[model samples]
Target chain A: MADQKEEVKLLGIWASPFSRRIEMALKLKGIPYDYVEEILEHKSPLLLALNPIHKKVPVLVHNGKTVVESQVILEYIDETWKHNPILPQDPYERSKARFFAKLVDEQIIGVGFGAMAKADEKGREVLAEQTRELLMYLEKELVGKDFFGGKSVGFLDLVAGSMIPFCLERGWEGLGLEVVTEEKFPEYMRWVKNLEKVEFVKDCIPPREKHVEHMNYMVERIRSS
Target chain B: MADQKEEVKLLGIWASPFSRRIEMALKLKGIPYDYVEEILEHKSPLLLALNPIHKKVPVLVHNGKTVVESQVILEYIDETWKHNPILPQDPYERSKARFFAKLVDEQIIGVGFGAMAKADEKGREVLAEQTRELLMYLEKELVGKDFFGGKSVGFLDLVAGSMIPFCLERGWEGLGLEVVTEEKFPEYMRWVKNLEKVEFVKDCIPPREKHVEHMNYMVERIRSS
Candidate 1:
């Protein structure tokens, strides 16, 4: 209301699942905006200025105000756009969606991400067991629903995707770990296929080839370092 | 609407900051509800059924539906009961509040919690340095405002209070750690006093003697284990 012309700009780098989360939100909401692809190693002045606290992308600069953290940015987008809603209407239901999204980031799959990156052979085996246990826990939740959101991709889907898109693309496959196979997790497999068909998701997600390459490099870097 | 008698319930453990966060929200919103005191080691059947995934405390059950995660529950309470808003009105302003809350949970105070819990002498020294650095950063944000929310106790204040309340009660002082000291963090001290004066917070927070006893026991258990 204060600014005559509103501008929505995203500061992020390609291959970052966090940044991609917000990009998916914008695309899903059908909002037009400028995107500043920042070099993570060399943090941009704008990125530093906007999100001095975190100084990480994907910071959503809306009408000169900054919203950091992909999850926070997603909420801001949903609130501002008010169309094709990401979270449910009921407070109770909204909490469930937020929980799944929160789960993905905090403990559900995050532990697996780090353990896989650094664990030795025996450690990796233990991690694989734990990850599968967690995946099954999530799969049990999707027993009857078409999506985590039910009938459409919702907030939880985005949150889960943000945590493991890179891993889903190739890292898991390369590591010989299975999470969403139709054989093991029929509902989860179906949900993945359903997400792949969504136009917004297709537009926002990086290509499999580039994502795999970048992810592999990152994994190798982390492992070696 | 569907259920003429909509029952609100909270499943939580006493002395848990997460649980207390929800209690504060309920008290602030002035909503009457049933409080289910759960044994952390041995969770209740209702707790397991309601929050099958996490099974953690501060699960708000409304009209048979469930909401887990303290932050998510806070949002739900604010939305469901419109009075005494936890978050600000404007979307940009809401984002800022959420950022501070997120920061308190994720990074700023999380590091401090871990450091105080397990760090050795050298590590504690490094942690103290980082903690002071972060406190100074937050202090800069509070150059003009009375609270993180500015004037009234708000979401970020609740979040920060959730973090250091254990320390706020002389628990950390018993451990020879000074976090919210008047000398070290002058503005933070004022904010702590302001929060303590709030009726809702006073009603919900555990008394100093009990909290300190529980905390010291926890600290010893952690050290032994």
Candidate 2:
């Protein structure tokens, strides 16, 4: 990374947890980056050239090398900027962190968001049951831990924590489908509060009112369509 | 890894690409591991305990430390073993490998498999087109490469190559849907042949006749139910 003239740029969209993951990682690492807000409907030529495969936002270009995929980007950032140490040093612990983060990403984006987007009433019930089970699993994983990284905000905190605000906005408030409550998942709730207090993440995330407004619009569009 | 006494064990099921991935990686690294085949219908308690979240196979237990998820396991193996060096040394190159491997994993398992599993005649046509497009995208990525890893059979090759034989046996020969033929994807077809030639992979994969029989059974079961 030192050999080349260093220039870090992150192309991302607001209200996208995936994009926000990269944004938060950059902030956590104390890495200064140029944030390019791309319109999802009309992607920039630079994004198309950099990430021809996905053509999506949250493309990190460091020293002119492009890295797509949020989790992959997070890994790249952690590897490049070794100051914060979001991922664990031990191979076993790192693997576990990756596993849980993958679970949360796939569950929220693939199953929960997907079912919420296109499901009918019966489908919503099934989605609700599945979401509850997923949250419970995460709840168990977070027991006796202040963060997924344990006493510090780490990789899972950056990845999973980025999605929590959206869940709060869309699932809890907008759609009234509560998955994480203090009663059920006290640990996960605490993790969310811990993430919110982190100076880097606080700056990276949008305010609650803005998130609710955006998520409400998304919910309406997805439901109507 | 050398300093400590190593006890590597892998829990996997035969006729599964994900399982085969770990098998191939262990072999490529020349790591001796006890392979325990678990019946999917009745998952072993050890399997459940090791990977409580997914409860799936291809779990690698190294010195009593458990690692689940095939890609994460591959990374852990590379990190721990460090002899074969499956993942690239450069941060950018490593990120790219993770990105493409993830794309192939998600696309094949998520889109192609899902559509192929549940689609009708008309639906099959659309799914076939989608599959072809996905393959074309991959083919484009493999323009001048001998393998996805370029010089040697690396991470993407191991993860992706494991899934191709099943595609041939299940999707093409068994079901008459050929998304990857020599005419269309010579590089990919060549990759399939090349992966078959690797000593570890050759020893690990099920025989052609056996694969055909198993895939036929899967096709029947999936189609029926």
Candidate 3:
């Protein structure tokens, strides 16, 4: 039920989990939008102008109004679109979803990079333990729930799901660690398998080999410097 | 318009800006809530149980459901109490407000801590410059608007306003830096002035002398360590 004047455009990089979350949200809501892939190394002038503060993507330009920060954009998407809701209708549930999404962003994805950046295996192991500890919380959160959003994939699923390929798979692979083993995070692994069953979610993830290669290159760069 | 079954309780500390934001949001919405003052140094068992994830204050227990994180709690408050909306009506404006609130948290309050913790003036000056650069963005956002929320104190105001005493005044005073001077950031200064005039906002802020003393103690601890 988008208006004729409702033009939606997303400036994103395909490999970025942040940008992918936006794509998944837009697709999940059945919102039609143009995708402009940004070369983050040499960002476009439009990208700079739209998100002058962060100078990053995915920048959702809705009717020329720019929305940056992926989680904030997710909320905007849910509010703007009535169909296929992303966040739970209940405020408490929505807060929990938001809280987990943030935990994934800050604790999992944020710390995953640190684990990958470790110059030595011992250092990597330490960070990996920290990641596993954080993942245990999510595992506990997943009990009797198929997704963080429950029943069907929603806000937190998109957020944590976007990181599955890049962060969990490639991130652990590139770092030569197994922080998310099925033994340790059985429920979390089940949650991941459930997410994989979603076609739209699968489409949002980058190719594993290509993502692993990129993550390895980045990890090497981080370790070296 | 609160229900009879609705019971709102807040676990917070007087000196914590994070905790104060929740208090302000509750007061702003005219939603009556029990204020359980938490001793952070020796956090109570209930506080630990309520927010086991962060084990932190500013946890909102509403009808036995807990919502942590000050920004998330602010959103929860706005949604639960529809009257005197803390966030804007339009999706785009709400997104902008959330973005700035986040900016204030991560950049201003977060980095402001770094600026204060610097053992040397040169280090503090460097971080103070970074803080100033970030504040300038808020300053620019404040132009032509009475508050970041526009015409009234809203989400961003509560987020930024909570930090006024702890981050800007006591924070700067403790560190011996003047990053948010009236001359340097005229619009932001005006916004602060406007917030001070609001009675509820003033009540949320801690006593200046006590707060400054506490902040200086924190600064010294950080520096020495």
Candidate 4:
């Protein structure tokens, strides 16, 4: 149901997990919106104007006002529309979902990207530690649940699982880390499969080889310089 | 209104900025909640049980169920009890507010703490850069507005303003940073003063000396080791 009162537009970067989260949320809500793919390296002046502070993307522009940040966009979407609620009805359940979602934002998204972006031995070490910690926490938390939010794919699942294939392709799996081993994180692995199967997610994800090559190049550049 | 059906208990540490956001939200909502002071360093089993992954405060336990993360807790409170709503009525405004709030959480909270926690010169440099970026954004965005949400304090105000006095007291001002100078961030400074005057906020905030001492110790520890 596209409302005539306001036009919905999304300013995003293709490979950004943050952008991916907003895209999935919008799609799941069945909200039709225009998408503007921003070249993050050479950011658009419009993107800068919309998000001057962070200058990062997945910005959702509705009726001219721009909303930056993925989780916030998710909340805005949930509140704006009633259909296909991403958050849980139960307050506590909603909080837990949001907490884990924040965890993914802080730990996984932050460190995972940091690891790929930095090539220095010290930075890599820090990234490795952070990554290991995040995976360990994920392994423990996702033990029984099919997704982080339980049976149905909810906010936590969408936010946390969005980064999985990207992280795997970025050599997170090849980092000699045991955080997501089959024996330890069986449910997490299953959740990864489930996330990969989602149509919108499948369609939206960038090629793994490109991401890997970019990450490797970045890492090498950091290490050498 | 303390309804038996909606029993609310807040598990929090006295000095945590994150926990203070929830406390402010609950107070602003006029919702009477049972306050449980949690020792974060030696987390109680109950805290672990409530939030196994993060094992942190403030955890809002409602009717035997728990909600963690301050931002999520604010949303839950707003949803559960619609009185004095923390978010905006307009969808676009709500999204903008939430986006800025998330920015405060991600950039300010993360990088601010990093500055205080790290001892190395390089770490401090990184922290300085991030802090400057966040503050500069805040300064520009907050121009002419009494609060981020405008007119009256809202979710963004509570979340963003919570850090000000703490940061100021913990050597942010002493560091002679250009980002949050009085000339640059007049609105932010005014907002900080207003927040400090609030009874609930005044009661909840830790003493300046304690914060300064703790931060100094952390910095020294990081440097020495």
DockQ scores for all the models shown?
Answer: 0.82, 0.88, 0.91, 0.68
The C-alpha interface RMSD of every prediction is 0.9, 0.8, 0.7, 1.6
Q: At residue B64, what lDDT does model 1 achieve? A: 77
The residue ranges of model 4 lying beyond 4 angstroms of the native Cα positions read: A4-6, A110-133, A136-152, A173-181, A208-211, A221-225, B4-7, B39-41, B110-133, B140-145, B173-182, B207-225
Prediction 1 TM-score vs. true: 0.91
The fnat score for candidate 2 comes to 1.00
Which of candidates 2 and 4 is the stronger one according to lDDT? Answer: 2
Chain A TM-scores, per candidate, are: 0.90, 0.90, 0.95, 0.85
lDDT of 4 by residue, A87-129 (tens): 8888767867777777777767667756655646576667766
Report residue A50 deviation for candidate 1 (angstroms): 2.5
Docking level of model 4: medium
Task: Select the stronger candidate by DockQ from 2 and 4.
Answer: 2
How would the candidate models be sorted by DockQ, starting from the highest?
3, 2, 1, 4
Write the number of the candidate with greater TM-score, choosing between 1 and 4.
1
Candidate 4 lDDT tens digits, B73-160: 8888887888787888887778777777777776677677666556565766688677767777666767787677677778888887
Q: By TM-score, who's the top model here?
A: 3
Which digits, one per residue and each the tens of the lDDT, describe model 1 over residues B1-225?
A: 123366888998888888888888888777878998998689988888888777788888887777888999899888888877888888777887887777777776666755566647677557666777777766666667887778887787777786675443355655677655677778777777788898988887887877778777776776677
Ranking by lDDT: 3, 2, 1, 4
DockQ, prediction 3: 0.91
- Across residues B1-225, which tens digit of lDDT does each residue of candidate 2 receive? 343368889999988889888898888888888899999789999999998878898888888888889999999999888897899888888887888788778886555665556547677667767777777766776778877788788998887777755443354465666556789888777777777777887887877677777776776677789
**Candidate 2 residue-wise lDDT at A168:** 39
Clashing pairs in 3: none
Writing each residue's lDDT as its tens digit, candidate 1 over A1-225 gives 113367989999887878887888788777787899999689988889988777888888787787888888888988888888888888777877877777777775565665558547677667666676777767876888877878887788887765665444366655655545578878777777778788887776787777767766777877888
Alpha carbon lDDT at B79, candidate 2: 87
